[model samples]
Target chain A: MSEIATPVQPQRAQRYGLRNYLQMYAVAARQAVIEQLQYPAANMMFMVHILIEPVIYLVVWSSVANSQGGAIGGYTAAEFAGYYIIWTLVRQFNLAIGPQGFHWRIKEGRLAAELLRPVHPLLPDLGYYLGYKIPQTIYWLPMGILLWLLFKPEINPVAWQIAAFPVVLMLAFFVRFFFMWLLGLVCFWTERVDALFELYFAAELLFSGRLVPLEVMPVWAQNVANFLPFQWTFYFPIEVLLGRLDLPEFWPGVLAQLAWIAGGYTLVRLIWKLAVKRFTAVGS
Target chain B: MLRPLKLFGLFARISILNEVQYRANFFMQVLQSSLSLGTGLIVLNVVYSYTDNLGGWSQAELLAVYGVFVLMSGLIGSLVLPNMWAFMEDVREGRLDFTLTKPEDSQVLISVRVVAIWRLVDVLLGIVVLGVAIGRMGLEASWWLAFAFAATLIMGMILLYCVLLLASILSFWFVRVWELMEMMQSIFQAGRWPVGIYPDWLRLGLTYLIPVAFAVTVPAEALTGRLTPELLAGTFVFTLVALFVTRRLWMFGLRNYSGASA
Candidate 1:
């Protein structure tokens, strides 16, 4: 027991100090990447969803466009191809849609162990999520290029468009993770989040331009989508890459995404506090 | 076969009892069913707003297809999927050995152990939608058409069950293939739209490989009277073949499982 010293005080320091906390997350994230790399086949199989979804939508939307005499919402079949291919990239980079270990943590009573740890329970998981994406993004590059070739998306994005992407994409990922994280935390207050999550996903599906481009949506729906955070996750990055956003739209969009991220951080922090008060270790 | 039904009945009763204890889950299931049906309708509405038809399917016709899709999904989710997923779990944890040792037929036992009875909400919603769509479209009703729809629908369900059983049986060798299951689901979801929308290769893959086209779309075709005799006969033959193959694979997996456990 003496040999198994618990480093409680240092953990307290690390928990309070933002720099140390972030640094620890980096280390944990690095470890997660290594662990994920060990199962290359698993990663490859998993990545198929990221690749296939866009292809499916691309095929579906293209058929609709062709049926409509080759254009809808100012996007031709080729442009749709470009949009989905770019959408795939946006999605892969901002893979915040799927439940990321948070559900399992609560369900399995692993959160009790996490709570015992000196660090905030959420950061390590969040770090692991972000870390998992690093290698996933690396693997996605060749796949993205292959899709790029196959679809032959026609947009000639400039260097600035390319450069601005990582910033926007990172914010998208951050906001999405936090948003989903807040949703996942609802498990603490409810017996099940499954149905609630379905409704949440329905909202996301319509607004995120995952099923259809918001531009093609009716004016009223498009206006409503503009105010929602869902569009910032998938549609904004892809649309921006396609040079769809005008100059006035650009700064405001980025500002909105950042504000949402800040909003998510605050909301999650509040939820976590309430959640901890309710959390019980019954199933570990 | 009678014995299998009895065994299934017992398992299903226990599951229904388990589910009914939680009244909230009943309401939740209804909400989720509505949510999914709403998602499909909204997607249909949005696409139809831009185009008159999707792959030669008008909105109401596609809505009919969606109804069958939902109905079939409920059938699978209620009985087949939860059991299969549980079977995979048992395979991973070596609890499957206990299943094999039971006096009852292990295949039947493992396949009917879990039932999400709440999925009836989806089934109810699906039939209502199908009824409304048929009424709205006025697509020439008849008893023979109903018979054809039932036959094709049963064939589709059997084929889906076979495919799911086969996939789950693979867990004997490769335990963590939940990703593959997720992939299958995404592919299965493509069945919502008419297979005609897909390119030739994809259409063939959905037809012959996953059999999703047969599982959902062909039944919809039968209901709409678009299904020909050749298609009907082909689906029947294919279902028989799949059932035979998956049954053999299940036996092989049991052998592997018991051998490893022994």
Candidate 2:
């Protein structure tokens, strides 16, 4: 019948305009907000799960700094507290759909349904994760306050730096999101990618200043980090909020983030075309 | 006790047979464990670069702690966690009814149901690291210390098993308990560092609340010459009490479970 044929043809030929894409993102993000908000207790526990990592690092580094007579690698114990407390917030913001989720999507045939949609699947994911930040931040607030009270962290961000925090925070999210998508696209090429994923995460853990400040890392590691995009996600934003980076240092970090975003976006677009061409669904 | 041991051996054999068919997983496990061990060493190296000792632990002694952490993680990963996850999934799907109907202790059956055999690579790797750390430290070797280490390691495994089993038994009341399980695991990562470095409240929590101190730290202490007689005796008592409580809770949870399918 023309009804079925017409539906297939139009879907094949149709392209979404900018306004429609924006609306799609809004809806996807709203759905994520509602879905996540429905599971508050689980999300709170998940937040605690996330928070423990930074707390461990904070405690370790604080002790080390104290043991060294109140300072090491230019960080006092209180500053270390401030850095890792901000780390908790940055962690919430930069959380993205991991490669494991992508592997599951493919294995479970969820990607088959996604392929039928006119818009890129990545767009919806971006919107969803963007929306996820809302619920995530809500969950983070009580924990953040508790950490602040418990640690008595000393952060002194100036007015302009404070104003710029949200912008950099969102940019950091984009950088990590795009890169995570790029990582996830590897699922298209191989099913046995766990080792690769592990390697990638280990590199990120070290290079991203997630484990320790880049300054505190050895010179070799700090040099390696300079050439990587990982630091822009965790280190830059935390420093911006911790009042560590000055204006001279700040603008270049922002530019680097924007540059990485553009690079990641381009890579995803190019590889996605190849990935889609290779994808063949077995069944519904 | 012998029956439970036999059951565990049979289940472990079957699990090994099932897993060995996918031999590539062993390589994957190796890669993952090595990467984590590498990162852990890097963190220790960086920390020690600034100081001679951390919480009175020399670099080699901390490496011993790291070794115990990796080893216990392997044992838990291979023996405890997979079983707990499978048991929780079974509970959720009403498969617990089948488990309950089996002609054996349900707790032992559930506890030993699954073994991720390849994860024992971590156990092997942990022993190697401990050997290197001890070699580096050059401590006086004694049978008493070795006995203490072996005893604490067994008790640590039991304490960890009891805590994890207690958490798993909660699935009868709640549909989703994996998040809580995950939170507990994250809290356990605190053991990668000695609990002595943590603040008072957290140290107390890790020691008594979750028993990660007993699980990883005390065993490491046995090797590092930090285990005192009083603390060792206290840990043993705690382990026994935990095992008793877990048995009672398992019975209670079994009663609470109504088969979703039946």
Candidate 3:
């Protein structure tokens, strides 16, 4: 018998390491930028909508604070400004997989093409979203600065508060991304996600610290909000940056975020499996 | 004009028939509208928990404003918004050629071509809310007040039509104006509150530029007995001028359409 030379095959896990994932992320991010830059005017229009809400709230909350004869929810006028300004950046970071594309794919029978691809249907969409943030971030910086200058919000954070902000924000983005993807997946079971989306949006506005700080929300509502995953998405990060949650509260907050992320990922994986089984490669 | 009117009537019937085939959509619309109206009331509740009045309107008075917002929102959702959305679709898919070839006026045909009849759910809800609000406010519904409210609401419809049509017409010259339409919606959503609460610049913009005040606030004012003769007259005049200008712009858009097709 003759000895045969054999090639050593790398393990599947080793094939895609940190570098490969980083490359994938860069490609996805770049593709997103290219797609969004095609419509500068549309991007500008979106910026107007994005900037409008926080501005409206900034004014609304400021007036509410004034009428209360000092501060409502432990936030003075300047504190409200600080909350919304940082919040503007936080929101800028939180634009996840778009509902529009999800709806369109189902409505137009284009999800079939996405499913046929070797990659997960969500990867390109995530890339597309990251690209979307580039323009949004560019627009946000100037707008945030202007809001900061205009409102002069007294947001003096300690070193760790400033440093830990981005990490918490990234977690918020993933949680939002995964949770919203679950909503998008529900399009598989029904043609009308419009009502569902509206319901989700209403709940989010109430709980996510977008409408008012969660602190000022009625005690019952705050308790309900804390039980849910949404508070981790916006309000938690915003408060963390404000140094509202001290070290003891902060560690638990981080834990809650991790728990939600783990829970969301599991839910998405399970739903995608069951949904793909039910899916007819078209609108349900 | 009579021919176009008849054509519009036919188009509206067709749209209703098409939508009625999907019976589930009606229920979904009701659910969505209720949820939307519920959110508005909840926000109001939250705000009023802290203060009695917002921007000079008491709780009941603000509810009156909300009722007007809902009513106009319903009418727009059922009529103007769907058609404008369809018009953008037409522009994109080159379906405008069919409407242009029709004997009736193109603008009339395009404008009333589709109606989501189920959205009247919001309109009826609006009336109910308004009645409750008005009843709570103890405002007299003089026959004159009724007439004035109707008149201002009609003007509001006209102004809303003008704004939506103008926004849709931009599709003739550009692509993907969905964000613009959405921008309009968010701005209009602010009308759920008294535009009075907004700053001077935003108030001015909502009143004139976006015209949400005309669509919602002014009629609300009529119900609340806050409508001044000057404001009513101005709204009427503004609607008239806007109608003429939008018509002119529509005509110009038609010319552009023809030029594009050529």
| B-chain TM-score for every candidate | 0.96, 0.98, 0.95
Candidate 2 chain A: worst 10 consecutive residues by lDDT?
A1-10
List, in order, the clash count of every candidate structure: 0, 0, 0
Error of 2 at B107 (Å): 0.7
Steric clash pairs (candidate 2): none
What's the chain B TM-score of candidate 3? 0.95
Candidate 2 residue-wise lDDT, B110-215, digit = tens: 9988999999999999999999999999989999899999999999999989989998888889877999999999999999999999999999999888999999
In candidate 2, which residue ranges exceed 4 Å CA deviation?
A1-12
Instruction: Supply the global lDDT for candidate 2.
Output: 0.91
Q: Compute the lDDT of residue A151 as modeled in candidate 1.
A: 67
Identify the leading candidate in terms of TM-score.
2
> What DockQ do you compute for every candidate structure?
0.65, 0.79, 0.65
Worst 10 residues of 1 chain A by lDDT: A1-10
- For candidate 1, the docking band is medium
Model 1 residue pairs with clashes: none
Higher-ranked by lDDT: 1 or 3:
3
Candidate that scores best on lDDT: 2
